[model samples]
Target: MQTGNLLPLVLALAVLAYGLAYMRSRAVAAPLGGIRHLKSLPFYYAARASLWCGLPALIVLALWVAFEGKVIQGLVVSSLPSDLMPESEGQASLILSQISNVAAGKLDPQFVPPEIAQAGSLLENLRNQSQTFKAVLVLLVAVLGAAFAWSRVAPNINARESVETTLRRIFFVCAAVAVLTTVGIVFSVIFETIRFFGMVSFWDFVFGTSWSPQTALRADQVGADGSFGMIPLFTGTLLISAIALLVAVPVGLLSAIYLSEYASKRIRATVKPALELLAGVPTVVYGFFAALTVAPFIRDLAEAIGLEASSQSALAAGLVMGIMIIPFVSSLSDDVINAVPQNLRDGSLAMGATQSETMKNVIFPAALPGIMGGILLAASRAIGETMIVVMAAGLAANLTANPLESVTTVTVQIVTLLVGDQEFDSAKTLAAFALGMMLFVVTLLLNVLALKIVRKYREQYD
Candidate 1:
């Protein structure tokens, strides 16, 4: 078997071994003696043993899987006859691939030399021996570790407490991993953005009035001067988000109000799922719907009103994006609205307030923070949306407020910048990372602010 295909078998064996060890440990320690029982259960001991035995071996196996081919190929190439070495790296890779296939008893149609066959046989034997040795070593280590751990289990052991502590530590480690991953992603974006800034001044990137990323690569290339203005992209993003919020907020809020306050059990059950279905529809489908259906409709309507509209316009994209985000706003807002104390509504009713007055004056004010939090979340989603904008919004970065005009967003710019074959180090390519960092920072700030507002408001209600 190929090295790549062996990893799953190795992982499956390790997992199976862990399960068996756990069950064995449980069975061995079942009878609890008076006042001498373990502080932790037998299962905890088993799990701990399994973790120690399996985790390290699995990590090594993964690393080996990732780099084993490269290491082995390098060794093989270095040992190859000088005349057999291909002149081009591409050709060398092809030869190596053929060698691998031949080693697995798959004949290469292009080059079936006798020497190649011999080399393949030798490599296959080495691979098989290496795999067997590794598997045996791992099995021996795991079994020994489990046995040693089982031997240590005693009546005085605090197995339950130890297990609880271990689990807590594991949860904390998992949390740390999530946080570190986010930090790592942010820093990676920041580093690349800094590189982009080095090529173009920070002010030019931020406030320049024109954005023409298409620049000359060669000195002789004329008409190569490109503008780095981001004003248009920012404006387009805001415009689309605004249109979406306008479409979504009222409809979503009203739907939330009806669902939470007035809808019967049957209606609530049917309507909630239907609304959620909107969220499940893929964004790519929305993109085509915007481009094929919504854009054309908007253009025809504009013509009827004696106004001009492009086939691909901000209004169409924004409208579709808004429709997409309705669930986000409505679902969250509904929950928050429902969370408002029933006693407040009861008191308002007793004081002769109408339902509308109570909702408008008391419930809404109380739920405003949470509602704002939901809106901010929706806005963040709209900002990051790509496919719909790429399809419906034109690529032109026009810094105009007219919804009928074609415009682009930061996301669109990022997509365009990185779409084709790209050199990672180029200013154009790195600009995507800079835009990403900015988008991340903006979204992060909005989330933090929204959370703060929600917390303060929640404290007031408490």
Candidate 2:
């Protein structure tokens, strides 16, 4: 049976187990004058039965599904003749792909060697057997667990403890999965970054001014040697992010203040959602807007002002990105400003302070740490943005602080480096990981600083 089809069956069986256990628990309690005489309620007994019925079966199904493909593939590879065996991991992967395509009838039998065709046959047969065995095993386990729970559903059994313990374990497992995933990602990037620094000098990547990463694939090609300087990328990133922050911070902060403190309820209700709708706008649409609308306008404006600007400049992307990021800043700041206790405002007003003075001296000061945290988070968002940068800023790694000049960010270069078929061993490909590491470090520092600022100035109130 397919795993998808088997899930509903397991759920139905769990429901049936619950019903049966509930009845048995009631029967045990009825003779004792009510559920009051039982060790736990009938609901707990039923819940325990349902949990045992479903959880073990789901765990089995999960394990089987995770390893089924690899196990079957290994068996099929082993069945191949020794001479037909793959030499390397890549060869093995290619061989498995061919076998899978043939098994699924996506490839013709006559196009491949007899060994692969036979392996395809074995793969299909093993998949069928594996699916049948998995269903039988899962069903058997579910029945056994349900039976055990039913037999234990007596007046003396404290099924509540068992159910709560199981749920606690499940929660712990979920938390562990999230933490392990983050660890895995960091380690993967770290290993690749280490490999990258082996091929390219760390000082060259960090300090060199040239930013070309186009190493020739063959020795005869010109520019086989490439510059790996990252200063240009970082400069463009900062220039664009600075422009974005310059536009976003004042505008968003003021809007948040107006909505939270000054605006009427009706206007605040209407305008807040409208402003936040910008956050929901797809980044690709923002990219198109940056490319088609903003970039051209900036170029023409720069030309009219007797200033040189690229057709795609940092200013265009930064402006559009700032517009995109406004909601992030405004929403967070609005909530934080609103969270300042109403008493603070009343107390300031009672002290003969004007509204603006009250806001500046009391509310804004109270919310300053949260406001700063939100701004830094928005800055991180602007720095990590890729689509707008790619669309409006041309991919010339010119080390310039000029917003009107064409420039690319670290993210754009990372995308360019890993866009298509890439050999990981090459410095060009590995450079993406190195850039990612640097980006991570910068964002981490920003977040840490935000945390420090928040903790240092945080005020607690009843």
Candidate 3:
């Protein structure tokens, strides 16, 4: 049995252990006139038995799978003659790849030296032995854990307490992992950004007006120096996002208000799901629509109106992005409006307020926090959108307020910078991290500002 097959077998063993423990617990409690005499329910005892039968075995299996390849590679490398021993990590990696290919029969032994061929044979044998041992060890641990838990299924034991404690520990570990992972990502980006700043002056990258990042291969080449200015990108990002919010906010909010306050339940039922279907449409499909349909229409319309518009323009991307986020705003706002207390509506109505007045003064005020949250989410969606911008806005990074201009955003630039094989030492590659850090900072500031506004409004409502 291999590690993959052992996983299902371990689960099967856990199920068997649970049944046996459950029956035993019932038997022990039966003489005492029912399960009421047991320290915990039979369910708890069975659950504890299942945990004992599965958790340790899974841990061992995970450890084996994680370390098995590395351990085998180290042994094979160590067994090589001094003349064949790899001098660096790169050489070791190359040797390992060749050995792997040879062992898998993708490369014939005749194509490799005798030492490498021997190492391949050893690698295959060691892997086979490791799999066999791993299966046996995992099964042995599972049976031992099951037997131990089965013996402990007594009336005096608190199986529920033990199971709860284990679950609490698991939850804590999961939360810690999430927090640590976020911290790790932030630190990694910060470190790379610092490295990038060392090579390119912070003032130049931040304040330079030019948006080029193509460094020449030779010093004598034309335009050897690359510009790492981010102003144009950030400007385009905000311009597109502002346009998207303009189109999305009022339309989405108004629709949500009508759906929640005035529309019949049957209409709401028919319309809400259909509106939300926009959110389910794939972004690539939206990209294709924007590229093939919207951009050309905008360009031709602008021309007809005696205005110049790029074939790919900010207006087209923003319009499409706004349409995409309508569902997000509407769905969230409708839920929040409906969640406002019914008493407030009745109170306003009893005071002789009209339906519109009641909505504006009572329900909307009460649901303002949630409504703001929906708007904020929509704004974020617009800011982070890349596919529509790439297809319709063009990747030009022009620092213009005009919606008919060709433009690109920070996200599109970042994707372009990191598209293919890259060395981190180069400013072009590191520039992506710089852009990312700026975007992160701007987003954090937006979130903080939104929260402060929300808090102020919330206090007024309270």
Candidate 4:
């Protein structure tokens, strides 16, 4: 059976096991007077039975799914005649793809080699047998596990402790999976980045100002001495992000302050939702707005003031991105300001301080950590924005600090580098991983700074 179909079957069996176990527990208790005499409630016994029925079966299914393809492919390859066997990994992959296409009816059998047709037939037969065995074995295991757990349930059994222990271990495993997934991603990016650096000098990539990354097909080819310098991309990213922050922070912060501190309850209820609606708008819609509306407006305004500007400029993208992240800042800051202890505000006011003084001295400081967190989040959003920039700011990678010029960001370059059918070993493709590694490092540093600020402010308040 397919994994999706098997999952529902397993869950149905678990539910059946739970119901049976609950009835059994009640019957055993009724003979011994009542469930009060039992060590744990009937719910625990049913839960334990459900866990036994589901957990082992799910684990086996997972392991089978994980290794199924490799094991099947190995068997099929081994069965192939020596003369027809692949000599390299790439050849093997091509053979597998052909076989898969034939098996799936995507390729005509008469067009393929006789060996490939035979292999496709073998693959289909083996897959059928594998699914049949998998379904039978999983169901058998589920039944056996449920029976064992049902036999163990009695008046004196501590089913609560057993269930709790199992749940605790499951939670720990989930946390471990999350951590290990992160570690795996980091290592994979690092490995690709190392390969990228082997092709391009680290200094040239980091410090050089040129940004062209098209590699030459031949050494004699003209206009393809690819420069992989990342400075221009970073410069554009920071310029746009700075513009976004300059636009977002004051407006968002002031809106938050007014909403939390001065607005009536009804007004807060109505206005906050309307304000936060900006966050729900699709980024692609924002991109369209940036391209069709904001860019033209900025260009017209700059021309009116006798300033030079590109039709697609960073300012247009940054302004729209700032508008997009406004809710992220205002909502978080407003919540943090509201969470400040009311006594501090009252104490400042009691000392003959005005409303603004109390707000500045008592409330803002108390909420500074959270407010900084909001700003950091908005900054990250702005830095990571792609659609808005791609739409409003042309992908020129201009190393200029001017917001009125066309430029591209690291993220835009990364997307450009990996957009099509590209070989992974090429510097052009691997550069994406290097860029990702740098972006990850930059975000990590921001997170660390945010943490330090939160800790410092938390210590002061505590």
Q: Over 4 Å off in model 1, which ranges?
A: 1-36, 49-53, 66-70, 80-130, 341-352
Off by over 4 Å in 4: 349-352
Give per-residue CA lDDT, model 3, range 1-462, as digits (tens). Answer: 776789899999999999999999999999999999999999999999999999999999999999999999999999899998999988989999999998898999998999999999999999999989999999999999999999999999999999999899889989999999999999999999999999888999888777999877777998777898889999999998988898888889999999999999999999999999999999888888988999999999999999999999999999899899999899999999999889999999999999999999899988999999999999999989999999889989787889999999999999999999888788899999999999999999999999998999999997
User: Model 2, range 253-298, lDDT digits (tens) per residue?
Assistant: 9999999989999999899999999999999899999999999998
Structural similarity to truth (TM-score) of each candidate: 0.84, 0.94, 0.96, 0.96
Q: Rank the candidates by TM-score, best first.
A: 3, 4, 2, 1
* Residues 1-462 of candidate 4: C-alpha lDDT, one tens digit per residue: 877899999999999999999999999999788999899999999999999999999999999989989999998888789987999999999999999898889999899889889999998899999999899989999999899989988998999999999999999999999999999999999999999999999999989899988897777998556889999999999998988898889999999999999999999999999999999999999999999999999999999999999999999999999999999899999999999988898899999999998888789989999999999999999999899999999899899998999999989999999999999978989999999999999889989988998999878875
List ranges where model 2 is wrong by over 4 Å: 459-462
> Per-residue lDDT tens digits of candidate 1, residues 1-462?
444655565556456655665665555556654332455555666666656556556566667567766776776676667778778987887878777889886776346766566667667776776677666665566566555655656655655665577679879988999999988988888889999998888899888879888877875787465677778888999999999999989999999999998899899999998997999999999999999999999999999999999999999999999999999999999999999999999999999999989999889989988899889889888998989998999899999999998999999999999988988867778888877877777677878878898888778766
lDDT of 3: 0.93
On TM-score, the stronger of 1 and 2 is 2
Which candidate, 1 or 3, has the higher lDDT?
Answer: 3
Backbone clashes in candidate 4 total: 0
Q: C-alpha displacement of 397 in model 3, angstroms?
A: 1.9
lDDT by candidate, in order shown:
0.81, 0.93, 0.93, 0.93
> Model 1 misses residue 131 by how many Å?
3.8
